[model samples]
Target chain A: MSGTVLTRTALGAVGVALGLYGAWLTLSRQTTAQIVSTVQYLVGGVVLNDVLIAAAALVVGVLVTRGLPAVVRAPVVVGAVVLGSTTLLAVPVLLSYGRKPDNLTLLDRDFVGGWWVFAGVVVACVAVAVVVRVRRGAGGSEPA
Target chain B: MTSTLPTQLPGPTPEHFTSRLRSPAVAARVGLWLGLSFGVCFLTGLLSHYAQNTSQPIPFPTSPSWGYRVTQGLHVITGTAAVPLLLVKLWTVYPRLFERPPSLRVRQLLVTGLERVSILALVASSIFMLVSGLTNTASWYVWHFGFRAAHYGVAWVAIGSLLVHIAVKLPVIREALLGDVDDTHSHDRATAVDQGVMSRRALLRTTWLASGTAVVLTAGATVPWLRTVSVFGIRSGDGPQGIPVNRTARAAGLGDDELGDSWRLTVTNGDQSVSLSRADLAGMTQRTETLPIACVEGWSANGDWTGVRMSDVLALVGADPESDVTVSSIQQNGPYYTVNTLQKNFTGDDRTLLALRLNGKELDPDHGYPCRLIAPNRPGVLQTKWLGSIEVQA
Candidate 1:
């Protein structure tokens, strides 16, 4: 084998070993029921992201991009992505899912307002970019 | 069996993914940062796990005072940053899901199979770690198993699979990265065309912005200066003594009688033993130290703790200078973290204190009441609030 192949093979071997050890740790440390639950979450997360989240995102992208003026499309797409992801990250806190009645300090932020403000900022920035692109004239599709 | 089966399935193909932005050039660039973020998170996570282990092969350091703060802050910040990076990466490479193997040969099929398996592991573990970590920081316990153990285990799986992935895609990654971001060339599907919606550079910029925003919104729990804008931060640095309380006295089930005037902090080393009441402890030599109580969940706050040095307490009992001590809480029936080891380095450190006051005032009932252990370079969970007794390890 060439040097590259030799390096790849060595790396692959180490990766396999580490992966197995990790799996073993998960299996041995947790009880049977815990392991089953963990696997469900682990596999479930992938399914949720790929099948549901990614599909929905793609569908939205196609729908939103259709019939939009070229100058505004990029900003809208970028805005949508940033807004969606920030919202997703803020969801747990927004819902106050873990908020304790006694402990006012935990999850005490005004997350809804924060998210809205964030959304506003994103929208404003996207608007500015769109306006700038429009003013710069059409066919401003050059790579950055 | 293979001969009878159809060669193709009725679904989207590589050509179906026609967005010009979804090219290897974009994927490779985003993947570089994503990989770096994961690497930082993994190393820092290892440091955190090692720091919290019950048995220490090597004693955790007690200097810098802000070591754990920086590492854990990085751990959470980098993990949060990975969210957008991972999403963009998946979007860039989603077309590959529809691509077919080069040939039907046994070796080719095996290689493709291995590659797919590694990808599955990487994606699943990455998503799981990020989601679980986010929920954990929010104190949202939706699962039954211990969060730390599962997170740690899956982290190994994630990093391992990630390494394998890099090794398998080395050539493609090198080619994509070495070229310009817009140089799609052979990497893009034939159907991909410039719709002028978004450039590859624009997408990369958006990904970085989203990651930075996520960090800014949540990192206030760790970075004090950004607290105001970090409106989504789990802890708002609001508590009894200008610091956030992880486990309240009420939550820990500590009643008035437990923390009453009659409360005594007992220190014992083998046959030697000494007990001091609240007033008695107050009468002893008091030292004040400003230290940050950093939590594993990534929020931290600095406090001015005034009390007797742990070294002084240990000396009162004539404990061995090199001995480690187990600090127990009054909440004997409480859940995990009720007991934690104070290694010799921490015990011997003059800055480590069994604090009786916070910000020059008496300890709040919720903030460990009469006394709590305040040590530098340690997890807040190990601080052992509502102190009951300390036993010198043999």
Candidate 2:
């Protein structure tokens, strides 16, 4: 059976998280300064997409790989890689939200470096998917 | 030990996932599109910087009045839309980033390593640029002016890496895009998604639509739309320059009108050349306007510019509106900044002129000094400063 759209369960988690974050930012009654601060945080996180742009990629990768045989699920694999990478990026923000801001995240000074490591991982995953697909094709008669 | 059957999914395990950098087609496509868009923004921004800081002029559209505004507005809008496009493009091509270096080859490893590093730089700096830019837009002042410096600095990194990306992947990009839109289509049965959903097609459509939406939203905000859905309303506030922050006036910085130079402007016309000094020119029709000087960065400010009508200057110089007039700068920097007839310059009203004052006072250094060109609804870039010469480009 085609494994398309079969991976919605995990994706649903991310979607829910994104929506919740967005809603919280929207509904919170903040002073102008507080609003500015929140907006700054939001903008800072979002603008990262211009370079690392991992969030949308993760979503698309998930959509692309949602269906496919296990042997060639390039999109789904890509999605997982991007998702994991972005999760690392979200760590600082979550830490900040949790009121336990760890200054060591280096988000302000080396944000691009941090985010790009995730992007780099995604690229690596795509290659792995290809190799696995090819090996599976070569070993057609071997295992059940 | 009674163990349940392993619930491992059939086929390749996650650990065996190969790299995408191996897929030259995907790598090349990602590299090219990303590089081009970044290049366009980088170049335009560089150009604007020069124009803003110096009195030199570039051959910008000068007619229809509102031309400069449209172009600069477009530049900002495009930059904003790039946020989403960059993300989506990276998502699609990110997989190729992981392909192993050419095994057993030193030369290939260096080449591949360089490419990977450049890609990394491009991704890293672009994220910095977008985040900083958006935060600034939102007035999220976490950092100091250092953020501005960082933005410019990262821009160079992004541009350099993007160029490398283009140099390496240009040929592949050309080939892939050579075919019609349908060529990008994939119909392989191995990767089909759900029944009514064509994934690749949907992706492309979504990308284009998102870009178009950005364009529309920006234009709507700038071009005076029947509706208003400007993202965050960056231009929603009012000051002289839409400088929403730093409102407290400085000590001893009396507003402009207090200076009261009643500056005179002189106008002269000769063959292919026109000269104007502050005195003879101001003798002509003097106009005062309180208009916001909107910038491409989505910032706006209201300044009172008092000056003679440029049309009258053109008339004295035998430069007719029927023909294009080239306005040049007095300061030694440049003479190329001139205006031509654009659609917006004709604001169905008479609000366009070369402004000479701000807030009832003579122009300041940070603002344009001596004199500068001003038109309604046009972007700040087109308003050239330091009055020098005007030539009718026949």
Candidate 3:
């Protein structure tokens, strides 16, 4: 085998070994019930993101930009993605799902307000980009 | 090149993905940073896990008091940054889902199968780690499984699969990375054209900005100066004392009775034992050290902890200054954090104190009243609040 192939095989072997060891550790350390729940979470995360989330994003990307002028398409899509991701990150805190009445320090931030401000900023930036593109008379001819 | 394979699948095929931004060049660029983030996160996470382990084959260091602070902070920051990069990477490669195998050869089928499995593991485990880790910052427990063990175990899987992925795609990655972002000669689909408003370079720039914004909005919990803009930070460096509390006395179910005048901290060696009351401890030589209460959840705050040195307390039972001591808490609720072993490195350090006061005032109940262990370069969980006893290992 060539040097490149040799290196690749070595890396693959080590990776496989490490991955198997991790799977074994996960199985051995957790209880049957815990393992079941963990597997559910692991599999569910893949399905949720790959199927639901990605599909929704695809739909929204196609639908939202279908009729829109090309000048604002990129900014709008980028803004939506940024806004969606940030909102997802802030959801746990915003919902205060884990807020303990006894512990005021946890999830004490005004996340909802913060998220709104962040969303507004993203929207304003997108709007600015669109306006600038329009002003430049580069009606989808130039790449942003 | 036309494939002989049937294209009767109902779903959208690779040809349907025509965006020039979704090329291998974009994936490779974003993936490079994503891989770096995961690499940093994985290493720091391992360090953190090892630090918190009950038995350390090699003792975790007590020097550089800000070591854990930097590491845990990097862990969260890198993990947060990976969120955007991962999303972008997935989007770039999503078209490959519909691509059919070029041939039905056995070797090709096996390679494809292995690649798909590794990718599945990588994607699933990566998502699990990030999502679970984010929820953990808020102390949210949506699942019944133990978070630490599951997170740690899955981290190994994620990193390993990522390594395999890198190995598998090294050739393509090298070619794409070496070339310009706009050069889509061989890496992009033949159907892909520059029809979108954004170029590949612009998309990458936008992704980086989004990632930076994510980090800026959340990293304030660890980087004290960023607290104002870290509006999404779980803790605002606010608590009863000058620092934030993870598990409050009330949350720990410790009533005033346990923390009342009857509290006595017992110090013990193998055959020797010494008990001291709050007043007795107060009369001892007091030392104060400003140390950051860095938590594994990645929030940290510094406080001037005034109390007797662990060395002095260990000396009461004729224990050596370098003795490893197990600090137990009066906390009855939590099982794991109720007891933490302080290595000889921590015990021998004059900076390590059984803190009686914070910021010149007595510690509030929420901040481990009576006395709590405050050691340098240790996770806040191992600080062992609400003192019960300290057992010196022979």
TM score of chain A per candidate: 0.92, 0.33, 0.93
Pick the winner on TM-score between candidates 2 and 3.
3
Per-residue lDDT for B139-215 in model 1, tens only?
A: 99988766888999989999999889988888889889988888857677788885547677778898998899889
Q: TM-score of every model?
A: 0.97, 0.48, 0.97
Residues B1-394, candidate 2: write the lDDT tens digits.
1122222434333233232222333434444555566666676666555434323345333354444444555555656666545655665554444345435366766777766766666566566666556545433555433443345545665665555555555445656556443342431122222322223443454455445454443343345451243322344333333222221112213234422344233343445444445556556788887665666555544566787666666666565543344555433423233332323222123566766666777655335556767766555545655544444443
**Model 3 Cα lDDT, one tens digit per residue, A1-144:** 499999898888888888888898888899999899889999998887889978987887787668687777877878877887777777778887888888878777888898888888889998998898888875655555
- For candidate 1, give the lDDT of residue B189: 78
Q: Model 2, stretches more than 4 Å misplaced?
A: A1-144, B1-36, B55-67, B144-153, B179-197, B237-285, B288-292, B299-394
Residue B354 CA error for candidate 2 (Å)? 8.1
* lDDT, candidate 2, A1-144, per-residue tens: 123233333333343343344334333434456545434543464355533545454454456556555444543443443344334323433233212122221112233343455356555765675676576673233211
Q: What is the lDDT of residue B61 in candidate 1?
A: 94
Fnat for model 1? 0.64
- What tens-digit string does per-residue lDDT give for candidate 3 at B255-294? 8899999998999999899888889999999998999999
Tell me the TM-score of model 2.
0.48
Query: Fraction of native Cα contacts kept in each candidate?
Result: 0.64, 0.01, 0.65
- How high is the lDDT of residue B148 in model 3? 86
DockQ of each: 0.71, 0.03, 0.73
**Root-mean-square deviation of each candidate, in angstroms?**
1.7, 17.2, 1.8
